[model samples]
Target: MTRVLVPLLRASCPPGAGGYGGSIELRLPDSEAERLGGVALVRAALRAAARELGWKAETFGWTGTIHGTMVGVTDRRTPPAPFDSVVDADRQRRMRDAVDRVGRPGTPSLPPTDEPSARLPTEEFLTAYAAAQGVVDR
Candidate 1:
């Protein structure tokens, strides 16, 4: 099964704002970028634009078990929030202990609760994309 990067905005934007050559910058995590390559990231943005216009995903020239990697597109107006953690509890605790050992007081070892993350699993992403594109209602 071919895998494709799926780029999505961290926040909703008004229509036409995310249009082509409009300075919208998309980004994947360092690990993902290393895994997927830069070309795949660009392709994801193109696919996103096409998909946003109601085009079929098949028309994008690849078909298989699509494993979508969630990425964020920077709108340039605001800096993005910290990334969500996929680490296990043990790892998180170890990290916190490491931080504590370093004497970094008041440093948060977990993701902030102020703003929610936009990153979603493939299934949830598809649903959200459909809803955002007006293909379905929540």
Candidate 2:
């Protein structure tokens, strides 16, 4: 299994107009990332998670393979929160700096992952992905 690296913010036109960016970023633990094998499972689980919230997942930049990760866009059905996009540019810069100082990317890899399928088994992958989203599989 492998950890997924998804972009923090990549909202579509509607979500952007709703001021849905520059929010606090949450880092998923390595243990959690490992459970999801690659981007497909992560995207699937995220889509499932968002569906519960009445939002649809529209992904952009899916390279298909683990190496080609993509960002999932969400429906902006809900009104913008007061805190939405409350973060200032300076603070955002500082956040980036902090991440650069302490944050690390997933284990570096090549065109293809070590695994034959280039991903983990679906069950294991979804389990971890769901857990990361705090979505207990039903």
Candidate 3:
């Protein structure tokens, strides 16, 4: 089974509001779920690991072939951003710097984590559509 850990954080929002973002997906063979005792177990393991590192974790249902697990310290005091805007480049850079500072020593450098726009998984959706059309293996 493929397992991945994604760091999450509260997006900078205006006064009295906040939102969540920053997540990654883990794509694994479907058979792994049977061996792993289902996604709940995988999610629990991720949460335990995050807790050991003093971070909070959460899980969400998979929308595609890749299942996602979100782990990070929660900032309840901060409000999420409005549906319109979430984060900009400057904010993302600052957030990445903060993570590098607090993250384990020698962690690999992370790529740019900026989301330019709010776009859904059109490509993924199309891939699934094509597979469903019998053009290729699943």
Candidate 4:
């Protein structure tokens, strides 16, 4: 399992205006993130943490859009498996083709299309994501 440390960005409260808040470190399962469900699970954890801490956090940067106004953490390591697995080879190829076409240099292309779908996690992925988040899976 890979671990990610996300840093929280604090909003400036006027000088000397103190508040009971600080950055937090979130450790997430590296394996799950490659899969769609993994992303959703991690996002949920971040949201819960923010709510409990009374802070508005936005997950941005390497970790992707996890939520609104929350801190996101990521280690530069990409795990193997599902991320490299070709469950839908044809679809994956098509997606790549589309990206290549649009990414052509000097070519003004349309924005990428959003494919709404659910992520199905492998048992291993689920287990790892849960453990990393410290959630008790009963």
> What TM-score goes with each of the models?
0.26, 0.30, 0.32, 0.27
Candidate 1 vs 4: which has more lDDT: 4
- The model with the greatest lDDT is 2
lDDT of 4 by residue, 23-103 (tens): 333333354354434555556555554444445555442344352222242222222354323323433555676676578
Evaluate residue 94 in candidate 1 and report its C-alpha lDDT on the 0 to 100 scale.
48
Q: What residue runs in model 2 are displaced by over 4 Å at the alpha carbon?
A: 1-35, 61-68, 78-138
Model 3 poorest 10 in a row by lDDT:
1-10
Q: State, as a TM-score between 0 and 1, how close model 1 is to the true structure.
A: 0.26
Cα RMSD of predicted structure 3:
15.8
**Model 2 agreement with the true structure over 2-41: per-residue lDDT tens digits:** 2322222222122333434322112233344444454455
Residue by residue across 1-138, what tens digits does model 3's lDDT show? 111222222122222323333332334344644344555665565455444433334544332254422212232222134522443443466566768655657776556446432122223422444455565854
Which portions of model 1 show Cα errors greater than 4 Å? 1-11, 14-42, 46-70, 77-106, 110-114, 120-124, 129-138
lDDT of 1: 0.37
Q: For candidate 3, give the lDDT of residue 19.
A: 39
Candidate 4 deviant stretches above 4 angstroms? 1-21, 25-30, 34-36, 61-138
RMSD of each: 13.4, 12.1, 15.8, 16.7
lDDT score for residue 11 of model 3: 24
lDDT accuracy of residue 124 in candidate 4: 38
The TM-score obtained by model 2 is: 0.30
